[model samples]
Each structure stands twice: as C-alpha cells, then as structure tokens.
Target chain A: MRRLTDVGALREAYDLVIVGAGPAGMAAAVEAAGQDRAVLVLDENPGPGGQIYRAIGTAPLRDPRVLGAAYWEGAALADAFAAAEVDYLPGATVWHLDDALEIGVSAGARSAVLPARRVILATGALERPMPLRGWTLPGVMSVGAGQALLKAQGIAPTGRVVLAGCGPLLWLYAAQCIAAGAAPSLILETTPRANWRGALRHLPAFLATPYARKGLALMARVRRHLRVVPHVAALAIDAEDGALRVTWAEGTAFTADHVLLHQGVVPTLNLARAAGCAIAWDEGNACFAPVTDAWGTASLPGIAVAGDGAGIAGAEAAALRGRLTALEALRALGVLDEAGRDARAAPHRAALARWSRGRAFLDALYRPAPHFCAAPPDAMACRCEEVTGAALRDAARMGATGPNQLKAFLRCGMGPCQGRMCGPTITETIAQERGIHPREVGYMRLRTPAKPITLGEFAALRKTEADRRAVERR
Target chain B: MFRRLPEPPARRIGFSLDGVAVQGAEGDTVAAALLALGRTACRETAVSGAPRGPYCMMGVCFDCLVVIDGLGNRQGCLVPLREGMVVETQHGRRDAAR
Candidate 1:
C-alpha cells in the first residue's frame, strides 16, 4: 500500500471523490474507475475495510460457509479494490465538505484540502446508545466497539462477558467474541424468538444467498456455548466490589466481568448535512438520513450518498448502492451508454429489493422496545443541560408539544455533544406524551460547525483559508 | 485456594448529589458513584411514565444523565466529578424548581 505524506500536495482533482473506504466507498471507487473516471477513496482508518471487514489479517476460517457470506464477498471486494487504479487515502478524516465539492481532510495534526468533480458519502453508521445503570463502569462497552477493539488490538475487556442487545449483528458479534476465546457469559437478546417467525416468512430470499444461510448456522453454533435469552431487555447494570452486576427487565440478574450492549445503528450524516445536502427524517429508524435519488445522487447534482450515510442498509445493500451510484455518475459523464448503465443496474436493483425486505423484517422484529424512551423520574435525558426525565415530563404535562418546545423550556438539546445522544429519545418521549408521531415532533435545529471545534482552531482555519482563496482569486 | 487481594485504595473526590454531599473515587464516573449508592431512578421519561438509569457506559448510550454544577443533563459516565461540584437529580430533562 502506498502512503502519501501530504494529501494536500496533490493538486490534480478527480472525477469522483468517495469519502469512507469501507464496502460502499471501495465499491464506488472500483466501479467508477472502471468507467475511466479518476477515483479517490478517503478513509479515517488505517485500512480500506470498515468496521465490518475488520480482522483482515486473521486468515479466513476453514469453514467457508461458517465464515458467512459477507466474509467471502468482502474478500472478493478487497481484491476488486486492489486491482482498480484508485487513489486510496487511508487515515484521512474528511472533516468538512462544501457544496462545491471541496473537501477538508485532517490526518493527525496535518490538514489538507482536495477538490473533486463529484462526491460520494459512504460514512456508514454508529451504534445506538442503550443506557442502563452502572453502564459507566470500565468494562462496559458497545458490542461494535468491543469487536473493533478485538479486531484492531486483539484485546478483550474481560474473560467473561455478557452480550446484550437486539438485531442480527448481536449473534454475529457473540460468535466472534467466542472465537476470540473470551466466552460470553450469556446473550441477552431483546429480539423475541416470535419475531423470527416473521423473518422466516422471508426465508426464500435468505435461502437464495448461501451467505445468509451460513450466518444463521454460525449463530446456531455460537448458541451452544452462549445461553441465548430472547425477548429480554437489560434494565440496569451496577459495579460492585470487583465484578459487574446486570439486571434484566424479566426480573433476572447476572454477574460478569464485562457487559457488551448493542442497540441498532443510526447513519452518520453530519458531513452530508454540513455539505448543505438536503436531508429527510426516516420514521422507520427515528433518525435523519441524507436524501438521495434512485441512483444515490443527493439533492446536489454532483454529490451522491450511498451506504449507511444514505440509509441503514447492511453491507450487501451498501455495495449494490455504491455500484449503482457509480453507474449513474458514469452515465452522467457520458462514459457509459444508457444500455450499459441499465444492464449493470438491473441485477443490483433486484438484489437491493431482496435485501431491503430482509432488512425491513429485521427492523420490525428488533424495533426499539416500546419503553426505550421512558426515562426514570430522576434519570437524565439531556446530558448536556442536566435535564432529567421528570423535568421533561412536567413540561410535557404543561403542553410541551415537541422537542423544540421542550428545548426552549429545559435546554435539553443545547449542549456540547449536541443532541446526537438524547435527541431521538427526547423526540419520542415528547410525541408519546402529546399523542403525536415522532416525525411530527421534528428534529433539533443544527447550526454549522456541527461538531465541537475549539475557538482557536476555527478562527485560524477561517483566516488561513480565506487568505488563500483571496490569493487564488487575484 | 489463593484468595484474591483486596482492591487498592481508590482515589476519591467530593461532590453533591441532589443537594446531598457525597464522595466518590477518582476513576468512578458520576453515574457509577450514584448507582453504587443505590440511586436507581436517575431520571424520568417525559411520556410513558417509565424510569431510566444508566444503560451503556461508553459515551454512546445517553442513559446515565445527571445535573452537574450548573449544566443540566450531562452524561454521568463521560464526566469526572470535581471537588465541591453541585450535582442534582434531573427531572424530565430540566432542573426541579428550587
């Protein structure tokens, strides 16, 4: 792999610049370059594989079927990226993207600015937070984070761990943890077995893909070592003496050295919004995702969003979307005739439809528990404003209609972390109290410099960039 | 059987919880300290009349929320308590009337 010391020094622009080097970004880079466009894939991580394709160095397990479909597909995808003449920038965080397709990238202390004719955002998703008592203890971690830690550092937080959460990834993660020799104490699954009946109805689609069957078999194998408790929720966690104590909603408790929680995921859309792309609220996921067309083009003509940044489709869907976006970009650039674009996108569209159904089934089965937004009277809802659930309840009782009104009264969304953590719950709680839908509750209005930036850095960057632009204009 | 050694002395800090003066270890987040003290209902939900405490400790989950000093609704796990800091129980995402 070639490493560029200074990405800023590359003065030549590209036909397409894809942000995030995961499945979506890699797929886009390969497909776009095949159409003869100069493609660049930028990622914050040291490698091309995103979190899903972590543990790259670990040899593929002997059981091809056991390794699951995405595993083999990922290997093939990696090969595709390797062969493509694409400029792959690892460890580069694209901090800002302007509407004009100008991107500001930061790597460690150094920063660079790159321009592109078109931008594709595949930034992926972040795990949803599931808070419980004693969760702040040292050994508690998100399942995704734990997996990342294991993949990147080969370290396990504890010898015995409890994996709790809902969704397909939960079992997959449990299997990985067991393979790493850290036997999970138990698997507390919020997704009820009854929900699988709905998933089973979509079995034909799953059967068509050997990977899907392998994923299911892997889960079954992992079930032998780990006790799987369905339709249960982890209520509270407390650290006592030296061990961690976890309580479940069904009136059961267990003790372990560490607890791993996995809620669903929400797309990371801050960069898309920062670039002034139009966004819409996804009622299904209770989050805002970037608005994209059939071809993954965002509201802006030259920019497109794919993968989780566009919506929380899994890896397969993301790859398909990435290829579709590339085809669209190629056709727009007159490289591919209409016939070519149509032929390439037809099979992808079919795959996307099949994947969407499976995802929808999973969504309904593992929908956030009804009481997810229910905070205790004294439980803190907005960590930023120090607002408690009780205080918000009082305001709601007094006719607080939405998050905006609740914010005005309690300053719930006005904190350094912004509302990324608390906004969904707050909106849901307000809607439930006022007898309204979450979408009707609206989202917290975000102002630019979406992430927290030190005043010094902001001022310095603004002045330097402004002077440079003025010189260029002259 | 070899007996496990006792935990070493923890670094402690003083802070107020809901107007009550309390002391916690340096490594303990405000939420951990509060939970260790058996304060289960850290905050209330605005709608469903459900109780919530700490859920995920890693900054991702927003469950363990408490009022610290003058700020309202801060993640207890993420914040380290300072000496003489005023921590209060949050009610429905706001401070209770004095």
Candidate 2:
C-alpha cells in the first residue's frame, strides 16, 4: 500500500477524508474510492486494520486456531483496500478539525490541513473504565492492551495469567488465549447475575438473529472449556512478595504474574466531539454517542460517522454501516441519484439491523459494573495526572459541574494521552454525583493541536507561496 | 508467556534499546521488539516515577512512550523498528529533563 508521508503530497482538499481505517473506515474507503471519488483514508496505525483486525495486512495468520476466523476475515478487506484507488495515509495523526471540515494532520514531523468536501469518522471504540484498588500495579492492565500485543506482534502474556472483568471480549480473548496455547488459569466475570432477566428479554430476538446466535455458540464453547467465575463484585490487585494477588468480593484470591482486565468498550469520540457533531447519551450503551441517521449521516451536512464510534455495533455491523455511509455520502456528493443510493444502501441497512439484534442482551448482560464505572475513592481515576476518585468527586461536589470547568480545578484530563483513559469514568462519576445524565455532564471541550505536537514540528510545517495565494484569494 | 507460532515473522532486523544491541523482525514495532526481549518497562511516570510499559499496543495508551532516534515521547508500539535505530527509555514527559 502506498502511504502518503508528505502532508502536501496530494492537495489542500479532497472529495472525502475518512478519519479511520478500521472495518468501518476500510469499507467506506473501498466503496467510495471504487465509485471514483477522490478519497483519502488516514489512520495513526501502520496498517488498515484497527484494533480488532490489527496486523491482518502484514500477513494472514494461517492458524485460525489462534486468533479465530473473525480475526483472519479482516484480510479480505485489507486486500480490497490495497487494490482500491483511494489514497491511504498510514502513520498520519490528525490532531484537529475545524468547523469548516478542515483536518490538521501530523505525518511524522510535518503538519498540514486537508479540507474535505465530506468527512467520515470511523474512529472506533475504547475499553470501558475499569479502575479499581491496586489496579495500577505493574502486572495489571486492560485485556484490550494484552490483546493488542497478541494481535500486533503475537506476544502472549506469560506465566500465571488471569483474565478478569465482564464483556464479550473477555470470553473471546480467554478462548483465543487458550487456542493460542497460553491459556489463562482463571477467568473472573464481573457481570451481575441479575442481568440475566434483562438479557432474556432480548433472547427471542437474539436466537433468531444470525450474528447473535454465533456469539451465543461461541460463549457456550468458551464456558465449557475455560474455568469462569461469575458475579464478582469487589476486586483488588496487590503485589504480595513478588507475584500480583487478585482478590474478589467472595474472599477469593488468585495470584498471577499478569492480570488482564476487560469490562466493555465505548466509542472513541475525539474527532466527532471536536467536529461539533451533535451527541446524545445512549443509556443502553452507557456513553454519549454521536447522533446519526440510518445511513450514518450525522447532523452536519458534510460529516458522517459509522460503526462503533457512532455507537457500539461490533465488527460485522460496522462494515455494513460503513457501506451504507458511503452510499449516503456518494448520493450527497451527487455520485448517485436518490434511487441509486437507496437501492445500494438497502441491503447494508438490513444487514445492520441483523447485526444489531443481539446488542440489547449483550449490553444488558455486560454493562460495566457500577463500581467499575464510578471507580472507588481510592482508585486512580486519571492515570495521567494521577488524580484519584475522591479528588474528582470533591471537584464535582464543589460545583465543578462540567468536565471543562473540572479540568481547571484539577488536571484530570490534561495529559499526554488526552482524556482517552479517564474521560469515561470522570463523566460517569460527575453524572452520578449531580443526579444527571452523562450528556448533561458533557465531555471535555476540545481544542486545536488535539494530539500533542512539538513546537519544532509546528515551525517546520510545509508552506508554499501557492498555498498562501490560494488562502489570500479566499 | 507470548511466543510466535510456527510461522516466523517475514523479516528480521537489528536495533538498539538503551544502547544495547537487540534484533527484531522487520514488521516488529519497537514496543513488540522490546517485549520480545523481555524489556517491559519502557519508561517511568513523570510524577510518581513508577515503571510503565506498553499497556495498549494499538497507540491508545501512552504508557509505551520512548525516545526513538532523536524524537522523544514517540509511541513505542506505533513506531516500527529499523536497522541501527537508537531507542532510549523515556524518562517522563518530554518537557521534563531526561
């Protein structure tokens, strides 16, 4: 795949600029570019596969026994993206986007703004908040982090490893680790047992649905093989002598070299929120999601979001929504007539519903435990600034109602990692204290230079007389 | 705990970590390469000085920050390894003195 390193390699603008190249972004790019629109797909990673299908382009893992078939399925899209006419920019970090749909991108040391006629953000998901006592210990990390190692480099957690927390990925990775030949000794499930009634309400629909049925079958297989504990309430990890000791509510403890935690995933909303897209709280998903139409068109005329970033719909639905989003944008760009767009998007829209069938059950069953969401007082709420839960609660209690205002009093979200790590927990915590929704609590206000950029890099940004003349003409 | 299956990486290259010579595959990210060599603590916290390594390999968690070539605070997991590349354990924030 040809990567565009020079910020000015192409031009100042494009027909479309897709922000991510995951299952959604990849699908959107392939479809849009195949329609012959000037498309550019930019991602920070070295390849197209986002976290889910990461490293699929490098080489297809021959052994499905390891990463599972779904992991290898990304190869098909990777190959398609490789063959497409779209300009793909890997290793390009888009720092900021303005109200006018201009994207500030940093490729290595150089920075440039690419204005797009239409912008699609398939930014994807982040693991849910899982702060707990002693969680910051050396051997402890989120299962998402561990899975990234396995996906990107085939590196598995060695020694006595215990997979903890509740989510579909918890089981998926437990099974994957077992298949990969480094099975965890124990799987601690934190899903509240009472969620079964809520999950069962969606059971009839889930059983009839194709993707949900597959998920059920997979969970059954994992349950049968792996030793799993359900209804874990309290959790703490502390270093005892040398090994990390994991303790749960029932006075049960397990010592392991590494403890991988997973709860669930929330949409990554940096670009969407920064772009001023209208957002609403999705109580089912328990996060503020960008409001979008059936075809993934956002409230903004020129911007649209697809996949988990708009809301969590998993991989299959992400691709479907991506395809539908492309059709919507295509029609808006006058590439297709109304009838053509409708016809093309009809199949994907239907498929999206199919994939979304089991979501209610999954969301109900695995919604992050309350304590995990609103981390306990002792736990570190912001890993970057090293702020604790009590500190944030104090800030909110003392009339720091908004995240932006809270940031001034306490440096909770102002770290090199931005607010990705702590935003969810802080939002939920503030919302709980105020007796309001997270949307009412609001997210951190975004500013320019979204990702950290050095001054030296900024000063060296490529500029030309032609660019100046164009700006002057405007 | 982690081992590549029978299928080997497509290519191999050599690089240095904290001035020590270490060999890694072509597609290996600096973080992966370091993890393969059993070097998990890529840096220390800026405030607390606690050891931190590559927590999220997919460029999300900034715990994997390291000095690559001459650039400080580069995400180790995102930056690919190269022949004769120089990498140092990042002390903390780039603004902070090494």
Best by DockQ: 2
DockQ for model 1 equals 0.05
Which residue pairs clash in candidate 2?
A: A156-B2, A158-B1
Tens-digit lDDT string for candidate 2 (B1-98): 35554465657788888888888876788988887777767888886777777766777768888989978889988887889999998885553763
lDDT of 2 by residue, A107-217 (tens): 867788778988888889988768887777766778988787777767778888888899889888887777777777888889987888778888777777766766777
TM-score of predicted chain A against the true chain A, for each candidate: 0.85, 0.94
lDDT of 2 at A326: 85
TM-score of each: 0.74, 0.94
What's the lDDT for candidate 1?
A: 0.68
Q: Please write out the lDDT profile of model 1 over residues A174-213, one tens digit for every residue.
A: 7765665555779887775566765666666656765566
Report fnat, model 2.
0.51
